[model samples]
Target: MDISTLLAQASSKWPQAAALSEPARDRHLTFRQLDQALTAFGQALERLDVGEGERVALLADAGIDYLIADYGCMANGRVRVPLDPTLSPVELLAQLRDAGAALLLFSPQYADVAEGLRGEGIRCRALEELTVAADVDLPDRPAQPPQSLASLNYTGGTTGVPKAVMHRHASLCAVLQNIVMARGAVLGDVLLNVRPLWPIAAVAVLAHLLSGGQVVLGGRFDSKTFIDQLAQQRVAFSSLVPTQLLRLLRETGSAPADLPLFKSLDIGAAALTGEVLDGAFSLFDGRIAVLYGMTEAPWSCYLAAAQMKALRQSGESAEGVVGRSLFAAALRIDRADANGIGEILLAGPQLMAGYWQQPGLTGEVLVDGWLRSGDLGRLRADGQLEVLGRCKDIIRSGGKSVQPGEVEQALLSHAAVREAYVFGLADVEWGEQVCAAVVLEGGASASVELLVEHCRELLSRYKVPRRLWFIEELPRSHYGKVQKKRLLEVLGVVAS
Candidate 1:
């Protein structure tokens, strides 16, 4: 069944219930109102000649208009390509062109940026202009084939340029089902979402709506505002990347005493370190789940807060503990060595169809229905999974592959070290040399020699960093993954 059909059912079941809201803008929509707006927008798109399977690119920040345009396209049977408005003009244009979008929609704030894309020959429509009067008949919702393309979601571009991941209607429904079951979502739950709506957060929005929950949308991530919303709205659930979590911890110092309504806090899109987890547990008296997945497969594995507490109490390493696969997903380690470390492979109903307009690249990763995650990990004896790091992130020094995550974990184990990023730099003799950049905690101090000695105690000599630099913070992608490319750039070494 089409996702829109499920959404229609939700509106019918909870007509007066809050469906979407932007507190900053003072905009709120009940389920029935949201459905009506979507139908109106769908009618407007139809009048503009937008058709089934057509690509409509949306460049806007998270807001009511964004959600309207997204579901509007879905109701019209058009594939919506949501591009991050924060991206560079060149990057944005490249994706728009790659998707072969038939029309472009932009919010009022992005009118100037939309104008710049006029040269691309695509029809540009202001989001505000795409409206139908209340008296106009609503367009009939189009039938969406299960295998039809739903959205062209771009990857985080941590490894290189982002690829447009193609997700089908059925696949997305499967993902929603997995999240609803795993997260125990139910009617009347309130979800506070501060992340951008282009990719990951969109899934969260769908899961909440599917389970008949209220969604409180925040314009941008302000730690203070986020906390205030939790208390003010009695938000029951939220998702945050590690960077956001750390920032929140820094802002609040500890979880606010009055805000106890928040229930589940999901953290993912980057590795969750022990230090971050420790600080998070101190601040928020809620369940903190560590989720692990990529653009190709979402909600694949999750480590619940109880498991996290158990691991910490057991004094076990939680460096890459991403927990067991979801009930609807299957996970395996491909080409394991004696230590059972291998590339993480995933197969299940929720896996994306493939990358848009890149069959060669799709062929490289999707093999025989399994996605080559490019993430190296090992399944534990108890069925939990530990993601070591990306296969490409392995530092080859003197003929041995040094997992940067292990080195980073060792560095972070130091009492004074707050954060650490490990990578490889070009070395004529060694081919590639292990290098590290570290940030120290407040009132704490550590030297290169001290950190080197610390790693020496935990790692082999070859895995120890040959050089180290102290920095305020490590450069990271929007998703919170450390940008090794940027680190190499800072060191004046061109990454191979």
Candidate 2:
């Protein structure tokens, strides 16, 4: 069945159950109301004379309205182009043109940008206007096929030019199923989602609804508010990136005392450091689950809370252990080295159809049925998957290959370091010198010389950072993944 059918079935089975809520705005929708809203959005599209298979660019923050627009596109056989709100106007405009979006629906907060798009001769309107138009009666059309295009989600472009990953209704459904199974989602459960809806996290939100659970939207992820909302709603399941989880532990000092009903906390987007993992276990009582995947294939590997607790008890470092592949997913280590590290290859029903309008680029990644994940990883003896780093981010210094993650882990082992990012930079003699940017713990200090000595003890000479920069914070994407290429550009080092 298509996404529309899946949602419809959920709405029908639990018509009165809470489907979505935004506590910050005091907005809520029951299953029945949510289904009706989806229909209304479809009607609104019809009023705009937006036909099936046409692209609709959605530019808005994470909220009930954004969800409506996204599902509305899927329900009406329209292609959705969910633009990252963090992107600049130029970047957003480029995506709109690239996707050939028939209409641009934006939130009130983005009215200025929408007006700017209008000036560029693009058809645009405030999201609320669509809601108003949806109030009228409109006939329902036949359901789209499972193979129909559902979304055009853009990559973060950390490695190269960002391309939109195309997904069909079937692929999205598979991901939702994977999330539901991995998170133990159930009827009447509650999920507090603070991450933006434009990203893959939206699928997790949908998974809850499809499982007859309530999804409470926590807008913009304020540490204090997130804790309060969790305690207030008695949330059963939630998800966060590593950065958000770290900030929660630092800012709150401990977990909320009132989370008697909370069940699981899913962490994704980046790897968690050993220190952060310790803090998480101490504060949350070992309810942490680490998820690993990308835009093209969401939630491919899942490390459950039980496994996390086992690792902590055994004193094993979390490091790059992103857990086992989902039951339906297959993992392969391509061109493995002596230690078994290699580029990760994934094959699953959830893999993206391809890059939108870029067949050649898609061909590079999607070979046969396996998607060549640019990530380098290996399977551990314990059956867990250990992701080393990006294939593109490997540093070759003085003809010796150095995994930046390996050096960064050594630096992080030092007590003074709070956060660390290692990369390759240009050098006259080495061709590419290993460099690092570090963030120190509060009230902690360490000179580059001391850190270098510390690394020297743990790493090979070629792997140690030749240069180090101490910064208050590293640049990060909206989802908390470090933007390495952008970091180099900011440091005046040529992008690798």
Candidate 3:
């Protein structure tokens, strides 16, 4: 299953069942129509001589055309690198230059950014012009093996560099299998792929299309409509980050009309709080779940709704568990701190073949066929796993250690607190200070003293927020993960 097979399969099954659509644009392509669009884009890329294995950059808004260019690259054996278009030209150029990409494909809206890179000896083209009518003499490209390199998705590493996580066709196929097995996804499920496609889990949405399901395509995400879409499209499956889920649950109506048609809700891309997990589970009647994976390992653990419900019924909270392994993937909690909380290491076919062009870095983490996940966690005797926090996010203040996630959990449990992020800031006395920034629910405001007092009852005094600030909204990436690094910058908080 080269990723292209998904689109090919869909076009074969229900060519007229609306394969892709963006309601705002009044633009849609049936499976047959989608095939033509992909052919046109492939032919267009062929004319440009975008060779096999060459890195082609796609910086554009999410839509049907972007999907065309992505699979079109797969169809032509070219490795596609999808980037968030929100990046500044400087940051964008820095990555392109490092990738050694010969050709850049982007929408006309980003034409200025693409044009700016031309002076740097980088060939760039407007993605709008990347496609042409069927008459063009596009070169013939042969099919590629499933193990051929699929794409290099960039993610920030502990070293602070934008490391490319290499993924292959086989890895993606395993991911598809894991998704099908973990989610029980089926052909008739309506999927709204509203999250950015840069993250690896997003490939699962593409997998749904490949597995012959209805795909409601576009990057447009509106909470009101998102909640409405569940009933409107009768959407059975959907994926979103905690932030998007937060907004969706906060819709104006106490109980939105379409709140109940979902068969599955898979959330990832960031740590989901107990607040969000409880809210989502209760809202969907426990059809919601949290998927744990990274760019390097696409589908790893799955925490299903049943597990969460059981935990709650047993007087326990599904507080921090990311879930169990999916699709034969194995997980072992070998790291411990006298409490059995250690790093989670995994081994599976779904793991990335290696970091693209970063073998030294790959070797450092992938030891003996296992991925040494940098996350710190513990496995309960019953086998449910609880992720405490990333190794880097655990804060040490004075002599005691603090997991920022714990503080955040306490803050969000408050009815007035809509969202919270905790991190260590510089302090002359304690060596490091615990700080928090919260967004109140529904524009409601809370006194800083009152907020701190509430944390005193829910959290340890040391873990209580020393600094608290209210913001209209928290800064987030397109995929809805908080840009904690950026948030710290805005707060003028510096790590010691």
- State each model's CA lDDT, in order: 0.83, 0.84, 0.76
Say which prediction, candidate 2 or candidate 3, comes out ahead on lDDT.
2
- Which of 1 and 3 is the better model by TM-score? 1
Instruction: Estimate, for each residue in 66-172, the C-alpha lDDT of model 3 and write its tens digit.
Output: 78777777766788788767777777777777677868888877888878888878898877786543454333345569989888787772224557777888787
RMSD of each: 2.0, 2.1, 3.4
- Residue-wise lDDT of candidate 2 within 1-496, one digit each (tens)? 7888888888779988888998878989888778888888887788889999999998898889889888888888998888888777777778888889999999989999889888887899888776542444344445779999999998856234558999999999889888888888789899988887775667778988888899988888887777778888989888888878878887877653457788888887356777777777667778888888888998899998888888878978676788988968888899999999999999999999999989998999999999999999999999889988899889888999999888988998898998899988878799899999999988999999999999999988889899999888889865677887677767776754
Deviation (Å) of 175 in candidate 2: 0.8
Question: Stretches of candidate 1 above 4 Å error?
Answer: 131-140, 156-162, 255-257, 313-317
TM-score each candidate.
0.95, 0.95, 0.87
The sequence of per-residue lDDT tens digits that candidate 1 reaches over residues 383-454 is 999888899888888998998988988998899998888888789999899988898999998889999999
Scored by lDDT, model 2 comes in at: 0.84
Distance (Å) between predicted and true CA of 288, model 2? 0.8
